[model samples]
Target: MTCPRCDAATIAFSIPAALRAHLPDDRPGAALCTHCLTVTPLDDPPDDTPSFERVSDAFPANDEAAVAFACVLALLDSLVLYRAELDAVATYAETHGADVLRALERLDADDGVDAHFDVARRTRQLEQFI
Candidate 1:
């Protein structure tokens, strides 16, 4: 899976035993973005949906999809600092919509006046690796 924010490759990681009790039992693992250091909860893939088929369904031609794609690109350019491909952002926005994109923007925002400390910390780690 890719990082929802940066479209970077993600590594599957098991939730620590201590934290498992606080989460839903159905959550099997989490994915950590290599580039952005964002952690995402993961669930089992649905049985009926083939992954390849889902990939093919990502791009649906419609006005709403076009708007979402444009909005996501604007958000990435103005608000987000992480590197992301245009096609990947379009695909994600098409599938998830504007609300999810807004949430990601809020999570990654690092404005000097109202900094997000956790996001800044994670971003620092990414910078060090680069």
Candidate 2:
């Protein structure tokens, strides 16, 4: 990972924090852009950093995104299938929202996913309804 501040290659690392469920709020997925001193993630980066840590805004691995997606699926005023799809994502996150978000933050920051959001494959049925 390249730190926009120092323009250095960084890697994924973790910190000690509380896990409400399986995820830790203080130790969100992050990378060091400036000599391992600057760590940030897709969800919320440090206040000082100006440039984007993640390549894309839509983090597929982001639990927040997943939560958001699930919420969208649940809240979208669409057909039954749309509700079902969002409900599925919401359900999946409801149980493991924390840990999944942690993992997702790592993937999103690392650019491990090819596309922005992979829900297209998972929520294909939504197309027909929309």
Worst 10 contiguous positions by lDDT, candidate 2: 15-24
Put down candidate 2 lDDT per residue, 36-107, tens digits, no spaces: 233344344343422223433332344443333323322333435345544444445445442333333444
What does the lDDT come to for candidate 2?
Answer: 0.38
> How high is the CA lDDT of each candidate model?
0.39, 0.38
Instruction: List, residue by residue over 1-130, the lDDT tens digit for candidate 1.
Output: 9978778765554433333333334264555444554446667433322221121222223434433332232323223343333334444444644333333344455232121135445334433322
User: Which candidate gets the maximum lDDT versus the true structure?
Assistant: 1
62: Cα error in model 1, Å: 48
What is the Cα root-mean-square deviation between model 2 and the actual structure? 12.4
